[model samples]
Target: MKFELLKTSNAYAARAGLIQTDHGPVETPVFMPVGTRGTVKALTNEELISASASIILGNTYHLYLRPGMDVIREGGGLHKFMNWHRPILTDSGGYQVFSLAHMRKIEGDVTTFRSHIDGSLHTLSPEKSMEIQRMLGSDIVMVFDECTPYPCDYATAKESLTRTHRWERLSREAFDATDPLWGHTQALFAIVQGSVYEDLRMESAAYLTNLDFDGYAIGGLAVGEPKAIMYELTGKVCQQLPAEKPRYLMGVGKPEDIIHSIARGVDMMDCVLPTRNARNGTLYTRRGKINIKRAEFSKDFSPLDPECPCPACQNHSKAYLHHLYKTGEITGLRLNSLHNITFFLQLVREARQSIQEGRFSKFYENFCQTYPMEEDHSAKNAASRERRRKS
Candidate 1:
C-alpha cells in the first residue's frame, strides 16, 4: 500500500490524501466501518459499498477464533473470503486479548489469555499477531500493543508504554519476514498507548517515530475518558506523530468525535458506534440522532433523512421503519445500519472536501453546532428513552 498527501488546510491539521492498495484506492480522512467477524454486523458488502465506504476494518482476534486463519488462507485471504473487493484494515488483536478476555498474562514478548469464545487457553506473541494478519491478507495491519486501560495509574501506563515499544520492535521484525500474496502490499502501523498522560504519550510517539513504521495510531483514548480530555489528548498526540505518514485514531466515536479528531490532525478513524447502534434502532441524521422505534415516528411518513440519498432515506418512511423496529424485523436493522454507515461516510467525505478547500475550521464549527451530543446512553437504553420520550 502507498499513501500520498494531496492537500492540507491552512486553518487546521486536517489534510486530504489517498491510500493506494491492491483492492482499490482509499481517500484519506476516511471513516472505515468496522466489519468485525468478517461482516459489518447487519449490513452486507454491497450495502457498505453503496454507503461510499472506502475501507473496512476486520478483527484479527475474532476472526482467528471463529473461522481460524487456515480457513481464510484456504479461501485465498480476507478479500475472497469476505467477498469484499476494497481495502481492508486488520487490527493486531492485542486490544481484544487485553480487554475482552477473562484471564490474561503479559510477560516478555507473549501474552497468554483464556479465549472469550470458549475456555481454551491461547497465547499470542507479536510474531503470531503479524502472522494472523498476514494470513488474513489485509491491506493495512496494526502492530501488537497493550491498550492500557483508561484511569490507569501513571506508573502502570509508563510500564505498558515501555512494553508496547518493545513489542513494536518485535512486530516490525515479524512483519519483515513475510511477502504479500496476490500482489497485495500490506502496510504496518504502530499503535501508541500511553493512556491519558501527556509525557508517556510523547515518549511513546517519539520512540515509534524513530522506528519509522508505515503509519501510527493514537490508541487507548475513547475507552472511558471524558470528551474534553479525549479531544485534548488527541491534539497532544497528533502534534507528536510524524505528519508525512497517516495518523489513525482507533475506536473513536460519534460524528462529532470524528470531526473533532480531524480538526486535531487525525487522518483515519474507525468505530463500532454506527453499525452497533443502528442494529438497536438508533440512527444518525442531518438534524441529529433519532430512534426509529419512537412513537412520534408511528404516523410520520417522512424519510429517515431527507438530505441523505441512501436507500433507507431515499425509499423508506419513518412510519414504516418504526413498525419494523418495533416488531424486531431483521430488515429494520439492515436499513438502519445502511443509513448510519452512509451518514458517517458522508460526514468524513465532507470533512476531506473541506480540508482540500481550506475551510476545515468552518466545517468543523458548523458540524459541532449542528450535531452536539446532549447525552450519553447505552444503545438499548437510548432506544428505550427515545421511545418513552416520544410517547
Candidate 2:
C-alpha cells in the first residue's frame, strides 16, 4: 500500500490524501463501514457501493470462530467469500479477546479464552492473529495488541503497554514470514495503546514509530471515556506519529466524534454506530439525528432528509417509515441502514473537501454549533417521552 498527501488544512490537522491499494485507491480522511462476519448488517456489497463506501472493515475474531479459516481459504479469501471486491481492513481480534471472550487467561505471548459463540476454547497469539488475517486476505491488517480498559490504574496500563510493545514486534515477524495468498497485497498497521495516560501514550507512539509499520492506529480509547479525553489523546498521539504513513482511529464513534478526530489528525476510522442505530430506528441527517418511530411522524409525509440522496429519502416518506418500523417490517431496517451509511459517507466527503479548500476550521465550528451533541439526547428522550404520554 502507498499513501500520498494531496493537501493539508491550514487551520486544523485535517488533510486529504490517497491510499493506493491493489483493489483500488481509497481517499484518505475516509470512513469505513463495519462489515464483521464478512457482511455489513442489513446492506449488500452493491448497497455499500451505492452508499459511496470506499473501504469496509471485517473482524478476525468473528470469522475465525465461525466457519473457521479453512473455509475462508477454500473459498479464496474474504473478497471471494463475501463477493466484496473493494478494499478491506481487518482487526487483530485483540479487542474481542478482551471484550467478548469468556474464561479469559493471559499468559506469556498467548491469551486463551472461550468463544462467546459456543464456549469452545481457543488460544490467540501474535503469530496466530497474523496467520488468520493473512488467510482472510485483507487489504490492511492490524497488529495484535492488548486494548487497555478505560479508567485502568497507572500501573496496570503501563504493564499492558509493555505487553503490547512486545506483541507488536512478534506480529511484525509473523507477518514478514508469511507469503500473500489470493493475489491481494496486505499491509500491516501497528496499534498504540496506553489507556488515558499521556506519558504512556507518548512512549507507545515513539516505540511503534521506530518499528515503522505501514500505518499506525490509535487504539484503547472511546471505551466509555469522556469525549474531551479521547480528543486530547488523539491529538497527542498524532503529533508523535510519522507524517508520511496513515493514522487510523479504531472503533470510533458518532458524526461529531469523527469530525473532532479528523481535526485532531485521524486519517481513517470505522464504527458500527451507523448500521447498529439504524436497526433501532435512529437515523442521521444534516440537521441532526431523528427517531423515525416517534408519533409525530405518523402523519408526516416528508422524506427522512430532504438533502439526502439515498434511496430511503428519495422514494420513501417519514410516514411510511414510521409505519414500517412500527409494524416490524424488515425493509424498514434496510432502508434506514442505507440512509445512515449514506449520511456518514457524505459527511466524510464534505470534510475532505473542506480541508482541501482550507475551510475545515470553519466547517468544524459550524457543525458543532448546528448539531450540538449535548442536545442530542434531550431531543430524542423528549420525543420518546411525548409518544409514551400520548399512548
* Error of model 2, residue 240, in angstroms: 0.8
Evaluate residue 124 in candidate 2 and report its C-alpha lDDT on the 0 to 100 scale: 96
Predicted structure 2: lDDT:
0.92
How high is each candidate's TM-score? 0.94, 0.95
lDDT (tens digit, per residue) of candidate 1 on 1-391: 7789889878777889888888899998999999999999988898888789889999999999889978998989999999999999999998898786458887788888887878688889999999999999999999999997655779999888888898999999999998877568899999988988988888889999999999999999887666777889898898988888999999988888888899888899999999899988899998889888789999999888998988889999999999999998999888898899999999899999988888888998788787857564334553564576569
Q: Sum up the clashes in candidate 2.
A: 0
Candidate 1 vs. true structure, TM-score: 0.94
Candidate 2 lDDT by residue in tens digits, 1-391: 9999888888788889999999899998999999989999999999999988999999999999988999998999999999988899999999988885346899999999998879888999999999999999999999999997655789999999999999999999999999889887889999999999999999999999999899999999877666778899999999999989999999987999999999999999999999999999999998888899999999999998998899999999999999999999999999999999999999999999998888998998899899748423533554565676569
> Could you list the CA RMSD of all candidates, in the order they appear?
4.9, 5.2
Best by TM-score: 2
Error of 2 at 19 (Å): 0.5
